[model samples]
Target: MAQMIAPVASLLFSVVLLLLGHGLQMTIVPLASLSLQFEGFMIGLAASAYFVGFVAGAIITPHVVVRAGHIRGFAVMVSSMSAAALLHPLVAEAEAWILFRFITGFCISGLYLIIESWLNEFADNSNRGLIMSVYIVVNYAAFTCGQLMATLTGPESFHLFAIASIIISVAVMPVAMTKAAQPAPIAIVKLDLRKVFKTSQAAIISALVIGMVVGSHISFAPIYAVQKGYDAMTQAPVFAAMLGLGGVISQWPLGRFSDRVDRRLVLMVISILGIFASISITLLDQADFLVFLIVGALIGAATQPAYSLAAAHGYDHASENGYVRMAAGLLVAFGLGSSIGPVVTSVLMQYVDIDALFLFPAVLLAVLVVYLAIRVMHKDAPVAENKDSFDFASTSATLGGVVSPELLNEEDRYVVVPDSWEPSEPEEDDTEEAASVEATDDADPTSADEAVAEDPLETKAKASA
Candidate 1:
């Protein structure tokens, strides 16, 4: 195990520090903004801006990495992220914070790209699952710790922001000094929206709904804790940490359960649970800290796994080689929903009541429950033999499409062979196989849209004929 992980250990170390700082920032931002007298709508707008930058960075950062190279790009992003963290306390205005949040979002997206793609490159089929599991565990643990760290100081003070900045700045040291080989430049995955929708309406729609629900939950949950009389010093952080903790613990069990039954059915169950949890929280007005903490975990467990289930459901219907494209489309839909969720939730909180925070997600979860029911009625479950195994996916802002090992099939894989590698003696068939490969390489590459599945109805008609 140690031998297998040695090659990418430095990258994982960097991830630990990076996520720690990021987790702190996510917890602090909304609380700080509220303390600065920013309206709920402005807080939501700021949250929306960050996600907008996140989606934009996912699209544009590849080009930057391609031009600047991974190590250099990683450094630049780390520095920018650190600066953004410090600027939040410096400026103290809602408008300035919005721009700072956007910058942080953009840098974070790029940083995830560099780190995740490097991990992807380092992995092979033999140990890929183990490596990914390790990454996921580390990712969640670090982020959760960071959230808890918010309790170290008051959000109104600049100390917490400084601590976050210091952590982010320190994140650069391991990667910069490491002697590990740089991974290949990241590829831009083109999204096929129409094909994705046709592949599985359940997946695409669930992605959007889950995105909105989770996005609002993450951005505003701290504020909700404050309104419920939880002090930012201890209670609020514990509430946020419980959410992360629940997500980490519940993913595997829920994911494995979905592997046996219809994933759509599992999604409906999750949506129902989310609604129940949200309503429970709303009803428990000014509950004790322990009760609020338990409710936060329940809601997290209910909603956090929806994205993974939806993606797994899509894979059940997607073509063998189209996994990457399918994931890209779902990611875009999720990003759009995340960007819009906070704004809508904020408006409700501003004009309606503080409880709208939970009410908003409850309503979205209800819509998803209705949608999933309709889908279950309209479409038969994919045969067990045809189902794709569930792989854990996070609802947090990340480059999930790149990190998922299942998304890249052998035929469509992007690997970078090392310069030290050598070919073995060739067999008689090698000459012909080499010639075939040469010819295939010389042919024009297929456009991204052309690689996705055709219309489902047209495919069914052709199959019937």
Candidate 2:
């Protein structure tokens, strides 16, 4: 285990570099758009253009991996990033950068494919969970730091662009120089909505909402900070930290707490907490540093687990194959939501105060919470008829379909809830395979505390966080 992990730890930089490079690069695009006299709609089109690339790359990443192999594939992907970032400052107009952004997004999707596929192939079944958990943690941490890099120079400075390039260049060193055996090619996850929707509509809705909310923040949070009076440096860390710290503080408890209760209920509480956080930010009389911290912490906590909650809720009623298919479909919905979220949120920020940044998410959460509440409460209101448990063993589609979050079996199908969760004895496969697999990669806390489902937005004073 130690030897395998040591090698993994070295290769882990691929994820770090991938994250930092993308994080730093993305922070500047929207900021640049605003400075360039681009309209809100154009800026959004620029922002969402990346998703088109992201989705396309994901669809074909498998072929690239299979044909080229991991090391070669990874190198090819990172080189594109270098090209995209260095050429960024060279582009004279917003329109050109939009094309660059699309290329960057497309390349980055392959990058994730290479890394995730590597993890899937190399991680001993027993060790994959731990390796993956660490991989996610590193990606999250580096991303936050990359965002912090935004603060290194003002949005308009060429320094941010240069730094973004340098990060990508350095990303090549770890894997390119390594002697590790090349892993197998990547697999394209074909997300069929008809199949997934047949399993559960709630899943689709949950995936969309989560994507929109998260995508909105990444695309515009820096701009929001600039509006709130912080410079780029402060903005970078705060934005990245908000999301990173949100996962840091919440993943464990939410994972654990979710196991003990109805996950939908947990999501509702988180949503309300999220609303309260942003609402307080909106109403604050002054924009203090502490204000950002407090608001970020709260909002992050509420929003971070959103997908998971939606996933758990939707999975409660999903079939085994449905869980796998739905997971991938969720990624698609997430991509769609994320792609659209920025455009909608950016317009609100451009037309309204920066404080209006929260309005998009707040409104979404508010409606979702109310609808979910009513659905659960009403005797025959739609959307609450299933009772499946969350299954972490299957590969799940999250964050736009490059790879599923949980690396469960891509081939086998099984029910979501534990057989014990049902009134009957455990299924044979569930009984033997589950125990063996759980014993293998048991450290992923997401496994320990997931439950089957079931939100509100409390109003607050308006001030920017």
Candidate 3:
């Protein structure tokens, strides 16, 4: 572990700083927009613009990395994001902020691709899981600490923006000075949506819905707190932190449980719980702030693990060679849904009550429940041998996360045999011996049944047929 940590420490530090800035910026933007007196719809639009750019960047950034080596690319992206952070305070209009948000999103996505790809390159199969786990922990911890920074200064002030920019700017120094060799350029994945859907319909749908729920919560929860008359600095961070805390608490247990059963059943259970939690939040009076926070945590615990479960389910059906492509497709689907979530919820919040934000997700969760329930009735549970072990998936996971199957345990590694590789034909004597055994089995129906029963793969194949 020490050997693994030594080389990648700089990269991990850079990620922590970058996510710190991101965490601060995420909360600051919505709160600042509210202070600027922008309408709810406008605030939501500005938030959604970031995701729009994120999706585009996911598609386009790999080429940028290919053109410029990882080190140079990393510097360029961090600088761009820093500049965008500063620009937010200079212009307070929704239109200007939306454009800034887009730029920030694009740069952040590019940066994530660079950093994650580097991490993947540095990690071998031996320690990939540890590295990935540390990376996720840093992400959550840094974001939580960054949220606390908002308490140091008011969101309406320029100081917070400056701090965010300064943090992002300093993040560049570690990577820029690191002695580690730059990773090879990453290839842009060719996403086939139909193939991904065919691989796991439940996974694709769950990704979309989970994206919507999480995106809206990240972008608008601050606004919701303010509307309810809670202190933005204190209560909002607690609210956001609770979500992260819930995710941290639930990811492993829920993920481990899914590995043992049908993942779709887990998804159904989570959706039902999420529906109840959302409904509880909607029905609870504003005065019950503590209960609201508790229920928010429950909602987070339930919804946050859906993406990982869904991704694992999809991986169960995908070949090893196709893992990266399928995961990328799921990320794109999630991004698309995230881009739309804030807009729809914002409009709902504007025309309806602020509670509509929670209600919208509840309805979506209910839809997921119904869909998964129906799908469960038709499809057989995956045989244990065929299922992939679950990994803790961050909502912020980029293409790099999907590309590195080394992060999984050795037994769970998806090995894609090359299409050109074929089993050697048996020698003439061996073929005759095999035929004799087959003939003997054919002579005894009971022996054939026993043979079939002993081989789970054959049994599964026959069952499917």
Candidate 4:
């Protein structure tokens, strides 16, 4: 175990430091927007920009890594991220912050790409799942720690942004000084939504819906807590932290439970749980902070792992060779939903009550529940033996859509050739062919006589050779 971990320990340490800064920044951004008196729509737009940058990073960062290499690319991204973090304080305008948010999103996605691809290099079929599980745990733990750090200073002050920048800058050290070998160049996954949807409609749609509901909630929850009279510096951070903590605690058990039963059944149950939790939050509008926090945690427990369950369900039907592509498609679906959710919810919050935050997700979750029920009734689940073992899914939850060749088996590690691509025939070289015959004749004086004596087919084979 120590042998396995030793190579990636610096990578993991970097992850902790990076996520600590990122988590704190995630908490600070919306709260800071609110302090700047930006409208709800503007706040949500800024949040959506981050995911847009993430998707953009998915497309562009691979080329960056390929050209500059991992360590250099990682350094570039970390510098951009640190600059972006500090820029939020200098340029308080919503529009400038939107651009900064996009930069932050792009850099963070690239960082995850470098880190995950490095981790994947040290992993094989025997231990890939365990390595990724540890990565996911570290991600959530670091992010949760960062979220809690919001209490160290107010979002309105310059200090929190500076702290976030400093922490993000410090993240560079472990990765820079690491002696582990760099992984292969990262390749962009050519997402085939059509193929993935054909594999499992329930999975793709569930990813979309989960992104819409969860993404919007994460962006707005701190604002909601503040509006509910909770202190932004104290109670709101705790509220945010509790939500992640709930997902952390329940994800493993939920994943294992789904392995035994139909995953669609599991999705339906969680969506229903999500609906109840949303309703509970509404009813507890006047309840104490602790009560609201508990309900918030319940909501996280119910909804956060649904994407993973849906992914597990998709894998149950996907060809083993196609897992990377399928996961990429799912992330695209989720990314689209993540990008769209905040804008719609923000508009609703601007026009309607602040409670529209929860109301919007409640409606989406109910829709997801109905959809899962239909899927359950329409098709049978994969047999127990056919079901893929559940691994913690990071597609939409953490990694964005950053799939790489490392995720594929060693023999299968190549750029995913598109289904539409076909091999072209090699052109014949008449001059080279004639030269080869001439050389063969010169090399063996009897070759011409032997050619005539040889079988006609043998002669043709020799000529071709």
Per-candidate TM vs. native?
Answer: 0.87, 0.80, 0.85, 0.86
- TM for candidate 3 is 0.85
Ordering by TM-score: 1, 4, 3, 2
Our tally of clashes for model 1 stands at 0
lDDT of 4 by residue, 331-400 (tens): 6777788889999999998899888888999999889888888888899999999987776634336434
Give the C-alpha miss distance for residue 169 in model 1, angstroms: 0.8
lDDT of 3 by residue, 109-204 (tens): 777667776777676657767887887788778877787688777788899999999999999999999988665445445567887788888878
lDDT of 2 by residue, 130-243 (tens): 776776667667776777677777667777888888888788789888887654333334457887766656657767886778777766766666666666555544664575
Clashes of 2: 20
Once fitted onto the true fold, the runs of candidate 1 whose alpha carbons sit more than 4 angstroms away are: 393-404, 407-465
The weakest ten consecutive residues by lDDT in model 4 span: 456-465
Kindly report which residue stretches of model 2 are placed more than 4 angstroms away from their true locations once superposed.
235-237, 378-465
Which candidate number has the best lDDT?
Answer: 4
Model 1 TM-score, all chains together? 0.87
lDDT of 3 at 223: 83
Query: What residue pairs are clashing in model 3?
Result: none
Overall lDDT per candidate, in order of appearance? 0.76, 0.64, 0.74, 0.78
- lDDT computed for candidate 3: 0.74
